[model samples]
Target: MTNHTVRPRSAGALAAVLAATALVTLGAAAPASASGPACPTDTIIDGSRLASISPECSFAGDQVNVGGVVMSIPNPGASVRASSAVAAGYQDVPDVVVYRAGNGGVAAVAGDQEFGSEGTLAALRSENSAVAASARPSAVSTLDSAPVVPGCDDRTAYKLSGEKWAGAYEWSYNNTGSPVTSGVARIQDALDTVTGGVTRCGSDVDLTATHRYLGTSTNSVDVTKAGGCSEGDDRSTIGWGELSSKYLATTCSWSQDGIIVSSDIKFNNRAPWWDNTGRACQGKTYDLQGTATHEAGHVFGLDHVAPATHQVMKPASDPCEYSQEKLGAGDAEGLKRLYG
Candidate 1:
């Protein structure tokens, strides 16, 4: 069996202001586990092993399996939200991809990943199976925070694929590292604790990444300056916040299956997971698991946490304001509404 895992990164240059070291709240504690391609051991990738596993997500790692079993983020305009359930688009969840090392071995066979309503998703699966033999992995980034690709098409809804690249996409950490494993429930609890569960989805608006390379690229950012200071006048374009000149921007891309998506994870310099505030952002070096989970919500089509108080998706104004260690009630509702 092949073993694969997700990647990791250090902290970011500027501080977004949410306060919570390990932003996990559900699931049990266990080492990161693989749910795809059959893994007997953990897969490792260095500068040299990327060529062996030929790892691929539904569409450029945009689509991933939940708990290594269920597939998610399978369509465009499907309403991916950030950390808050009160927010309208928070319903969409990004898919999780699994990877493992491949050293001149044939790629392992994979089972069909189904989504949508039972019947709808089933038919789509059958259609995809007919063509699964020829599918290949797209040039999509597998990092937690990827770049945003404009004018990209969602996964085709029914298509099977393959790839020549070989390697596993490792999970930086598992739910055990998180405060909440059941992301949906954790989010709901947050809402009740704060707003008494009265808030509802606000808008069905469309959010586009002004920058490109949603998950893989290091360049393409709209905010921050070249000096990497959070306290410059120009750094206030987005707001009056510190900026980091060396942070790498993420790319956002679409999946061919028309479901999964990708984007970059942004972190504040003051946060615990982020140790540096004035250095460059390298997709290869930084590995903040919690921060990545927060960004994953956005990449899947969710927006920032709502109520600005509860929910992991909310934007932080200060290092202390960021407090979404888990998904709140609002987060769960948003997802069910989007997919269910």
Candidate 2:
């Protein structure tokens, strides 16, 4: 199906206002737990490695068992549409983290790092709850508007605080256990819509960025079945897998120094995926294109606003709402700020 939306204009003004708001809010927010038994000072001193370690490792011995990628998670919110717990809301886990362990030591869990996790993630959330609450919306982008759109104020959006595609990310597809009825074309179209050169509402929006599909991949996505990040083949992959009930699909991205290095998109095998955009929205079944479009936004560095805000970037999905296949005015505007 074709994508369409209201034409987008510059949201630089709104972005600036929201950014300034964040600066002030963070400055005033209380500090999260820094040192304690859960995270002793001897281990990177801040417990950044808590989420990826196993029970036996004692937060130091196991070390996520990945290739030197030490992860630290701290978000007191169940969020980004994918927020909450690894059990109830795996989306709360941060999709990207600072990749500077060698020189920077266990990267001091950035107060601004929106996504975070550590195994069960319960401790991480409580540890940072006050700080996270304090940093809530000091201001948001409401300058751009198209009330006809789902999120009436397309400006109600946010992007990953750090790391975006420094170049066009050539990704691969994996369909080993997909539940998509429409087959590969439908999924491919979704990927293309997100990468760049999409038209909305007969209006061409500047949604171009570096998200490309390099054909099918033999590897599975690095996202865990529980909806947390995992160390996989290191290939940027988009494919099918088991995800928690809360997510239509889960995305995990890896970055190095403010540049997106790789990412994985996993469509839930449990979801009854309907790919025919021409058809009406169905019960329980979600639009593959629409939902995947949102997951792709996360891959390309978009963050979730609130669901009530009503943009594609909202953290929750409404079954059968195919309009999400196209970037809303706010979605486009956010991309413009990052990629343009």
Candidate 3:
């Protein structure tokens, strides 16, 4: 995948829109409750050390926990309205309290920090519900067509000796914060979709096993708090090959690629994201499989197409749309030309 910049709507603006929409549909939204077994203290992001016999060592202690992790206050304060809780500590008096699930683990809440345990729990549930409602398919609108760019074949498309290599390539996922469990499967599916669908290329490209590799390289997809509407993006780069006898060098691996997906965005496969008027599109989230499929196209050498074309290579897509999970005619044509 080549690096192409396509900025989506700002995070702050998107949040506001979602918040307003959520308010209107709150009556119909599912009830949120804080009901689950006590989370492990080891997963909490608290600063205090608990003694072995300390009664305060539990999740119900001073530390706030969510999804089996202790939530930390955001540093430098958050500007987004949704982050009011985490931004409370910024001022002399903590007005709003916000907590994060360590290393952007997709859990965050904001409310009055001084509230009692019951109040805090209620606030957490409300915040989670509002956030969920805001991310619905109806909350997002498609953008205009993406600007055209040079296709993969135009430049170097990660090939060697004028031939796209055919073999199993090893890949690893960054499991530092939110462990890469199901995400790995999503990525694999995307890779297979492109390789198998593009039969015209013969057996020029095939991605094999994805295992746990402790070693670091440019080629990997890691999750972190990337502040933007875009779900994920990747960059494909080239490296120098072996030294030539005639004192010349050739391009080598098209393997130095980096992919990063936003931890802020919730990804799922549930459908019917939007209401009939397309106004109450809550509950539905972005499909990780579909988005990964598109990103994998870039890994296998594909570029962004105009949204009007409805190609998987289109620059942008809404949360509930999964049509891109499979290759479109335009997408297949492009792959055939390059791989064939």
Best by lDDT: 2
Measured with C-alpha atoms, the lDDT of residue 221 in candidate 2 is 71
TM per candidate comes to 0.25, 0.62, 0.32
lDDT of 1 by residue, 1-340 (tens): 1222332211120011122225322221112223232111112212122222222212222222222222222232221111211112223222222222122111111233322233333433443343343333332222112112211111111111211111111111112222222432332232222222121222121112122111222232222222111111111011011223222111122223333332222233322332233353343332233234344444333444323334444433222222333333344333322322
Weakest lDDT window of 10 consecutive positions for candidate 1: 230-239
Predictions in order: lDDT: 0.26, 0.51, 0.31
For model 2, state the Cα shift of residue 111 in Å: 9.0
For model 3, residues 19-123, the per-residue Cα lDDT tens digits are 444432211211121322112222232322211112111222122332222333232111111110001112211112232222211223222232224333343
Q: Count clashing residue pairs per candidate.
A: 125, 21, 6
- Residue-wise C-alpha lDDT for candidate 2, range 3-58, written one tens digit per residue: 22211112332243334444322112111222211222122222334332222212
> Considering TM-score, which of the candidate structures 1 and 3 is the better prediction for this target?
3
Order the candidate numbers by lDDT, best to worst.
2, 3, 1
lDDT, residue 19, model 1: 28
Give candidate 2's error at residue 130 in angstroms. Answer: 25
**Candidate 2 local distance difference test against the native:** 0.51
